[model samples]
Target: MPTGAAQRPSVSSPRKRRGRAGLVLLGLASLLAIRIWVMEPAVVDSDSMEPTLHPGSLVFVFKAAPQLSGIHPGDVVVFQSPQDNSMMIKRVVAVGNQTVEVRDAVLYVDGFAPDEPFVDHESIDGTHFSLRRIPPGEVFVMGDNRERSIDSRDFGTLPLSSLQGLVLGAGR
Candidate 1:
C-alpha cells in the first residue's frame, strides 16, 4: 500500500490551475456585465461638487436613475456639457417649469430658497442675476462650488435628455 510521501498527491497540477483561472475569468466577466448593465463607478473629476462630492472621490452612478424616480431638485446627476460636450456632475437645482435666480449670493428656487447644506458657503457669489424659468424638457443645474463652477449660470439650462444618470452613492 502507498503511504506518506509515496501516497501524497501533487497540489500544483495544471488542471487545478486552469480551474482557478476559469473561475477568476468568470468573476471578472460577471463584474463587467453588472457595470455595463446595472451600475457604473466613476471618479469625481472636479470640485464642482465639493462638500458633496470631493475630487477623486469614488461614486457609483445609476444608469437608470431617472427611470427609478424622475429627476428632481437636489439630485446629483451626470450629464454632457453643452459648452464643450464633456461630462459634468452637478446638483439639480430647478426642473422644468421652475424659476431660478441668484441675488446677493442667495439662490432662490421658484419664489423661496431651498435649504442647501451641501453647497460651499464661501463659494457662493450671487451678486445679481435675473430670474430664468426652466423651459420644458430641461433642468437647471449648479455646482456646489457655485463661484467657480461654470454650469447653467454660464451656459444655460440643460436638456434633460443629456443627462447620463444620477450619482447613487459613493464607493463601488
Candidate 2:
C-alpha cells in the first residue's frame, strides 16, 4: 500500500492563498462601489447643529439628494461652499424665491414662523444679520445654534450649484 508520500494530496498551498486573496479583493471592490455610488459618511465639525448633530459625530448623507428631492426648508443639508471649496452643513430654512427673515428673535419662513423646536434657548434671533427674500434657485441656510453661525446672513443665500447633498441620518 502507498505510504507517506502517496498520502499527501496534490493541492498547492499557493493556489489556496490566491483564492483567499481573490475573495478579499472582491469584498473591497464592493465596498468602494457602495461608497462612491450609494452613500457617503461625514463628520460633524462644530456645534452649528447642536441638539441635532453634535461635533465629532458621524453622519451619512444621501449622495443622490440634489438629483432627487432637490432641497426644502427644515431638511438638514450638506453642501460645498461657494465662497470656499470647504464643506458646509446646515439646515434648509428657506429655498427658491422665499423670504427668510429673523426678527424679534423669531424665524419666519415665507412670512410665517416655522415650528423650530430645536433652537437653543440662548439663541436670541439669528446673529447672521436679518435678511429678505432668497433669490431664485438659491437656498437660505442657518445653523441650529443661531447664536454662533454665519450662513446666509454672511454670504447671502446659497446657489443650488453649491450643494453637495442632504444628510439623511446621524450617528450619536
Candidate 3:
C-alpha cells in the first residue's frame, strides 16, 4: 500500500539517452540524402583554375542534369573526367553551336572576339592550338589560367551529359 507521493512516476535516464540517439540518427540520414541526391562539396586540387578557383579552395556542384539550368558560356562547371571518372572543374569556353579559334594571341568565337575579362592575364602565345568547331550536345571548357590548364584544347569537347554541374558560386 503506497501513498500518492510514492506512486508518482520515476523518469528513466535510458529514455532521455534514446531520444538523443534518435535525433542524431535523423540528422545523419538527412545529410546522407543531401550528399547523394542534391549536391556534393569538393576541393580544388590544382592551379588549373587559378585566379578563379585556387588549390585547396572548397566548391560545390549540383550533380543534376545539365539542362536543369542550361550550360552557359563563362559559367564555371565541374564534370567527370573523360579519361577517368575523376572530377574536373573548368570554365565553359564555348557551348554547342559555337566555333572557337585561337589566332594572333586571342580567342575568337564564331570569328568574333568575346570580351573576356577573365582571360586578361592568360598567355595564348605560341601554344599552337588548332581551331575547334564545338559540336552539338558538347561543350568546350578550359581553365582561366590557359597557359597551365589541361582542358578541351588537350582533351577535346566534353559531352554535356558528362558535366556534374555549374560551380554554384564559391564555398565558405
Model 2, range 47-105, lDDT digits (tens) per residue? 88887888998989887777787787888888876677678789988988788877766
Writing each residue's lDDT as its tens digit, candidate 1 over 15-47 gives 889999999999999999888866888888998
Better of 2 and 3 by TM-score: 3
Off by over 4 Å in 2: 1-23, 125-131, 170-172
Q: Model 1 — which ten-residue stretch has the worst lDDT? A: 119-128
**What are the C-alpha RMSDs, in order, of all predicted structures?**
3.6, 3.5, 3.9
lDDT of 2 at 157: 84
Q: TM-score of every model?
A: 0.79, 0.79, 0.80
> lDDT of all the models against the reference?
0.84, 0.79, 0.80
Error of 3 at 102 (Å): 1.3
Q: Candidate 2 has which clashing residue pairs, if any?
A: none
List pairs with backbone clashes in candidate 1.
Answer: 105-126
